[model samples]
Target: MIKTTVIALLTAASLAGVAAPAYASAFGDVSPEFRSFVADSIVADLNQKGVHATSVEEWGDLIRAYVTNDNGTQTMEFFTPGSLQPVTK
Candidate 1:
């Protein structure tokens, strides 16, 4: 009985995650391949490193990253797809 209860709770939690609402994403003009790439490679890594991962915009080799901050000032970061570090002009 105890084992069955644990499994039921776990199943409900899994379903809850799948039923979560969708929010706006930052990327644009991305291919299907790139979409999975961003979710698996980019978003997961960024959030793990304490960066409030928001959106990724791609243009050829140039990728734009937007990270929300607490202050009023807004900023956008740039980078190459393979390079996780932000690029500066």
Candidate 2:
């Protein structure tokens, strides 16, 4: 699980770099584009947490995603929206 999470973070960072050609660095007052990049990365991370997850929705500081479990749908929440840490409720 740790290995998967690490890979996810690295993948997100890579995607962000590709999304923005002018990406300077990973820290300090980054651009709005960088923030958006981070958000996208977070969403991807959430999607993988629940193997059946089909969609992701961002609400304020919480990140909500839907997954189709064996019986029905399950929702996953992440309290920290832009966190590199794994999905936290």
User: Cα lDDT for residue 56, model 2?
Assistant: 48
lDDT of 1 at 44: 48
Residue 36, model 2: lDDT of: 68
lDDT of 2: 0.52
Candidate 2 versus truth, CA RMSD in Å, comes to 8.3
Q: Write the per-residue lDDT of candidate 1 for residues 1-89, one digit (tens) a residue.
A: 99999977875564335311111232344667746544444554455666666766554566566777777444676655544566777
**Stretches of model 2 off by over 4 angstroms after superposition:** 1-13, 16-43, 74-79, 84-89
The CA lDDT of each predicted structure is 0.54, 0.52
For model 2 the TM-score comes to 0.38
Steric clash pairs (candidate 1): 27-56
Per-model TM-score, in order, reads: 0.48, 0.38
lDDT for residue 31 in candidate 2, whole number 0-100: 68
Badly placed stretches (over 4 Å) of model 1 are 1-40
lDDT by residue for model 2 (1-89), tens: 99999997888679666533322222224667766665455455555654454554454444455556778857564433434233542
